[model samples]
Target: MSAHFKINKQASMLMWTLFMLMAPLSVYLMLKNKTTLIEWVLFNVSSSPIMMTIILDPAGTLFSSTVLMISANVLQFSTIYMKDDKFIDRFTVLVLMFVLSMNMLIFFPHLMILLLGWDGLGLVSFILVIYYQNPKSLAAGMITALTNRIGDVMLMLSIAWTLNQGQWNILYMWETSAFTWQSVAILLAALTKSAQMPFSSWLPAAMAAPTPVSALVYSSTLVTAGVFLLIRFYPFLSSTTWFNQTLLLIAVSTTTMAGLSAMTECDMKKIIALSTLSQLGMMMASMGLGMVNLAYFHMVTHALFKALLFICAGTLIHNHMHSQDLRWMGNITTQMPTTTSCFMLANMALCGAPFMSGFYSKDMIVESSVFYSNNLIMLTIILFTVSLTSFYTIRFSLATIWGPSNCSPFIKLQEETSLTTPMLALSLMSVISGSTLIWMMPMNQEPMTMSTTMKIMPMIMVMSGLIAAWYMNTRQIKHVPLLMLTPMMHYASCLMWFLVPLSSQFTMKVPMYISHNYLKSLDQSWLEILGGQGVMSSSFMASNSMMKTFNTKPVNYLMMSSILMLLVLATM
Candidate 1:
């Protein structure tokens, strides 16, 4: 290799090494003395001359640690999953970029710096999602990029609006403006970034990427960035009643819709994608209802289980030459026993089986939703959504693991290696992390206190879902036509698609028209809108008319020329 090539290679290696090291170091630091480690990390984080400060509160520490652990595991898993890929250097670079940005996102004090990290993450995710460069993957990447950009614009606007309203200082701004229009703007940004209803179409499409990219970006990092943003700014949102209510409605709608959609999806990746959307919705709902701690708690737990689930899925798909359709996959439990077991554990967590990490976090969210909203309607919606979550998670498991053998003819089960280690670790974490909530989190709160009604409802929902999933998977119950059985849900998905136009209608005129004609347009017209016609049309017309008038005023021009000559002669 040339000298320049050598230098580039070394730089890439350094970046990869740094990222791999950060995870273990972070865990060690936390374990040594969590308080001191948090204080030190916060000090470093706050040293940046930003408008906000990084405070090492219990919730922040927990979230930060969870992100660190999952990012590390995903990076490790990627090493094995991407081993045979051609663009290994580029892949590693994006992985490092993702890790760096996520670290900054968690520790940054100011909203601006946080946004910088946020947008960086989105860029890296878009690149990873398009790593294959196939037409379909490229399209998926572009959609994800554009949708995330829309969310970013909303965030930027919120920041600008906040500054415009004289909320320059972070603490003061949040204290004074938590419940204002600014809060609504911020909430909208979060909703979009988290892929809540109407903004959720991009997520399912993103499954075109490699399984590791899906595991890392969609499962753990990028998808949850919005939820983390909301948690980071919880103090600001605490006072906004209307914003809170709106968030609550969005969350319920998203969770319910995602759960129903997951039931319809046969692709393993799409099932996981919808699961992520639903899980994120649950987090948002908790935050909307003023359960910041619980929201953060759920985020941590979800990250662990979801990452594990995705990694296992990646293992299966990779071993089988990227066959991701669950219907084509069946009864690999005998061949890939280790992988199957890990997946089952993660699935149990995902379904929120009792005593798993997912159960605690999910129960916390449901309990908090009931306590904070105190609306039986909201509670019922959330409960039903949880049941659907269980059903789909079970559906995913049965479709992939319990059906007749469809393992690829050419592929064989290989012994587990370093690549599979991360999956195994994550699966164990999913099973055990629930204990963290019981042991660490404050359970004295109303939701955690668990009244008789609260305890009974969650159990009933869980049992009902488990039974329902069992019946469906056993083929004892025929699959219902979504439109016939759940007309409202069918319409809700349609409504989500319909709202795209309605929202576009209110936001901008030309872009809406172009988006409506997106794929059909011979050439994109939105670019023309940005090329200055909207701003220059009237001015250009007026100038042309003025030129016409001037041409008609030839006598006036001659008089002016005569005056100029007279003045020149006088000066001479």
Candidate 2:
């Protein structure tokens, strides 16, 4: 038992060491304005060179470093979270494999070689999602796996389309007349993988996974893969105007949907998952506005705090005997001071509080986006979504960390090193990494001319969201449950505007119904009666009739036998 703990500790340390090494490399690459690509030519197909490629650009290195850092903290936290589980060692291996796949996705630029990591993420994520081995977990895993598979197919199609360009290396491919369907294909792939709009349901459903896995997968690896892909393919996809517009609509819808859903959510993990979804929308919106570097910056910064948020949430969940309902959690600050502080730090960052990591990245995204576009309605929706972010963040904080306790009177909570250590480590990053990365990375720092009103509008929106959420929370404290006040609105928001059913059950209903009817009419009835069973029954009746004839006429049978013997003797 002790050996397993040591193994996890060692693994976490090793990952942290790698993160330290990569972080400096990323900074150096960014400072030098150099991209290192090491390619091994394996073979050739006609004119195109088939090679294994590793790209060490600042973006790749920084993203990899972020992934490693978050994964290390998650692994350390998992040591406590899964301590009672008998297969902790097995869990560690799965996590390591998940990290490996994400690194592969990051460092490789070729579409063909990238599939190794792409498919690996989808496959491993499904395994992790269903790690608990229950019906709900299995269903969640299926939805996650199937939704990701859509992206996998689109990625494969993009690779095939790029084959015509004489190479699969996306780094060297310049936008030309030849770049058409591949851009759309890649966009679809990114959309599905990032859980945008119609594909958004699976993100919340995937909360069925263990908390450590959620921290790693949601914060840096699996969900962010789509955003990373677009950043890589932005040079090509940006030329298509329809792609940008389409993405803008999808991003706005997703952001609104996730924010509303989170406001109504009670489950602690799902709320965090929805918030992650909403953040992904912001990233996509940046991409839609042609701010790839800003999107990338947000992606890296978002990874830091979101991972911390999940770790803190996991600690609370672990101590609460795994009850994730926010209703049962309140006044946690008094019992676990260290954890509650870290939790609020993460939430502050998430809400884009001044000087927090989220403010450095998210504020820029909103400001730059509003400056870039002239569409008032779209901008309005995006601003509203930003407010929604703060709304849910405050609503969640009040319900769980600061609300009155609904648990047993004798419930006890304590901060363990295994839990607090990772939380503290991530909490530090959540505070500083955003500002640090924004300075270090050579992201587009274009000057924007905006009115004073425009400059503070995002902050204003955020404050309004906080006030509204506080009002709602106080009303809930005084009166009936939130569900009772507005049942229909709560229901729609909880279901993500019916997206859950539309994406999952609705999509499957028609096909599954058809299959069920086929089974009943063909396999069970017609095929059984007319195919195998009918043949057998007919043959059996014929044999029985012949047997009855033989039994009823023994003399005739003997005569026939004698005749047969005579004929056999004559032939011989």
Per-residue lDDT of candidate 2, residues 441-559 (tens digit) = 88658799999999999999999999988887787356544543677877888898899999999999999999999999999999998998998998789757866777657786688
Measured with C-alpha atoms, the lDDT of residue 360 in candidate 1 is 84
- The CA lDDT at 486 in model 1 is 68
Worst 10 residues of 1 by lDDT: 36-45
User: Per-prediction TM-score, please?
Assistant: 0.78, 0.93
Name the lDDT value of residue 127 in candidate 1: 85
* Reference-based lDDT, each prediction: 0.72, 0.89
- Per-residue error (Å), model 1, residue 70: 2.0
